[model samples]
Target: MTYCVGLLLDVGLVLLSDTRTNAGLDNIATYRKMYTFEEPGERVIAIMTAGSLSVTQTTLSRLQDAIDIPDGPSIMTVDTMLEVAEMVGAMLSDVSGKIAGRMGEQASAARASMILAGQRRGGEPRLFLIYPEGNFIEATSDTPFLQIGEHKYGKPILDRVVTPETTLEDAKKAVLLSMDSTLRSNLSVGMPLDLCVIPSGEQRISERVRIDAEDETFQAMSVAWSNALRRGFQEIEI
Candidate 1:
């Protein structure tokens, strides 16, 4: 399991994902769960995935193969972000079905889900949560965020703080603090984290940051958030 979150704000988009994947107690490992693609001045897309590694990896490989072909049904070739989400959802569903078929219907481990966030040259930026069956839900003004994997522990802050009016800088802090909360509570999710920002109308990624366990800034932020939480808890009336 892992944690991946994306925000579609009025200013731009923010994305974050953990790199941890584990099979069992002794099989812990780090694997990148975030992917980005861009044609500067044309468009940009970022994907954060959670669930079966095989399904996600194979689905991405197939998408990459399509991306290499001109005029293909790849994400880069899509005319709108909605089309891109449709293409991705179909690919994910196909790959998942194939894997689950091979492993028998009883194999629950073959499931996977992904969050897709991006913009096309002439369209509004969009965020989607693609489910295992080739369907997805888009982010709306009322709910400007989408999340996948181990989400419950970190959702509170987002529910309280995120909105269409959030600035890109504040959006970053919200996601980092959200991820920090998850990291402290869930053993399945870990870092280094992959974070990226795509400012509206830039048609490309403007900033990308990788935060590891040893990073001082992230450490300090985590400590600060922890202390704030403690103070808030103490302030509550009994």
Candidate 2:
């Protein structure tokens, strides 16, 4: 299992993902769940995945292969963000179907999903949650965020605090707190984490970072959040 989240704020896009993959309590490893494709001033794309590693990895590999082909219909070449979502959805579904077919009765274990966020030159940024069936739903003003994999543990803070108008700085805190919540409650979603920020109108990724388990800033933030939560809980009259 894993946890990945993306936010589409007026400023741009903010994405976060954990790097843990576990087959059992005794078998665990780390693998990055965030992938990016950028063409500097022309376009920028970020993909975050959660589910069966085989399915997600294969789908990403195929997407990269498509991009490598000269003048091919890849995420970078797609005319619109919608087309990119469609392309990713199709590739993910195709890869998942093939893998699941071979797995037979265990097909459900082979399912995976992705969150696609990007922008092209002269176009507005977009966010999508692509499911296992080649279909997706885009983020809208009413709900300016999308999350996958162990999402329930971290969704409350987003629901209460995030908005399309959120600043890039605050958005980063919101997502990190969201991940911190998930990490505390779920062992399957361990870190170090990957974080990316694409500023509005830049047509490029402005900030990309990795937050390791021992990062001091993240640790301090986590501690502060815990203390605040306890104080809030104590102040409430039940």
Candidate 3:
């Protein structure tokens, strides 16, 4: 299990995902869950995945193969972000079904989901949460954020703070804090997070970062959030 979250704000899009993948207590390992494809001034797409590694990896490979074909209906060549979502959903569902079928009685282990966020030239930035069955819902003004994996532990902050008008800087802080909350509560999700930011209308990734476990800035921010939470909890009269 892992934790991945994306925020769709008026100014741009922010995405973050952990690097941990675990089969068991002794089988823990690190694998990047965020993948980005960009054509600089043309378009940018970022995918953050959670769930079965096999399903996600295979789906991405298939998508890449399609992209290699000139003028094909791949994510890059799609006319709109919606089309990109549809194409990804179809690929994910197909890969998931085939992998689960081969797993026989352990089909549940092959389940996977993804958060897709991007912008095409002349299009508004979009965010989507793609389900395991090839269907997805987009983030709207009412809900400007989407999350996957070990999401419950980190959802409260987003519910209280994220909105379509959020600034890009604040959005980044919000996502990192959300990830910090999950990291504390879940052992399956681990360090060295991948974070990406795409400013609206830029058609390119403005910021992409990898935060390690010992990163000073993240450490300080995490401590500050914990302290603030403790103070808030104590201030609430029982």
Candidate 4:
């Protein structure tokens, strides 16, 4: 399994995902779950995936193939973020159906999911959680976020602290804490996290980071969060 989360704030969007894919105790391996497409100042899109490696990889590969076609509706040619999302969902659905049909039930159960987020030159930044079936739902002001795979453990922090008005910096912290929660609870989701930030109206990724096991900033943040949680528990009435 994998864990991928994205936050849609007033400022922009923030996304994070883990690389671990666990088949069994001895079959663990690492694979990238984040993919990006950008035209610099015109548009920028990021996709963070989870679930079955086969389905996700095939779907992504096919999407790339379509983009390579001369007249296809690739991410670069889309006029708006919503259109880009619709195109992705349609492509994912088509690829997943073929893979599932070929693999039959058990193998197809490993179907993947993805979180798509970004902006086009003339539109607002948007975020969507794409399901294994290829349908998707956007993040709205009321929810302000979306997540997939091993998401249960990390949802609490987001529920308590995240909102549409949260600053992009704070939004990033919320997602990191959310991922930290999942890491502690799910053995299948392991280290070396990928993070991406897209500031509103920039039409480009503002920040992206890969946090390894010994990354100092992530280590410090994790420790501080642990201590803070302990203190919060201590201060609460029994």
Task: Tell me the whole-model lDDT of each prediction, alpha carbons only.
Answer: 0.93, 0.96, 0.95, 0.88
* Per-residue lDDT of candidate 4, residues 121-200 (tens digit): 87889999888787899999999989998889999999999999999889889999999988999899989999999999
Top model number, lDDT: 2
Summing lDDT over every window of 10 consecutive residues in candidate 2, give the lowest-scoring window.
18-27
Q: Model 3 clash tally?
A: 0
Which candidate has the top score in TM-score?
2
RMSD of 4: 1.3
Clashes (backbone N, CA, C under 3 Å), per candidate, total 0, 0, 0, 0
Candidate 1 regions exceeding 4 Å error are: none
TM-score list, all predictions: 0.97, 0.98, 0.97, 0.96
Candidate 4 ranges with C-alpha deviation above 4 Å: none
* Tens-digit lDDT string for candidate 3 (1-238): 8999999999999999999998877899999999999999899999999899999999999999999999887999989999999999999999999999999999999989999999999999999999999899999999999999999999999999999999999999999999999999999989999999999999899999999999999999999999999999999997
Residues 111-163 of candidate 2: C-alpha lDDT, one tens digit per residue: 99999999999999999999999899999999999999999999999999999
Error of 4 at 157 (Å): 0.4
List all candidate RMSDs to the true structure: 1.1, 0.8, 1.1, 1.3
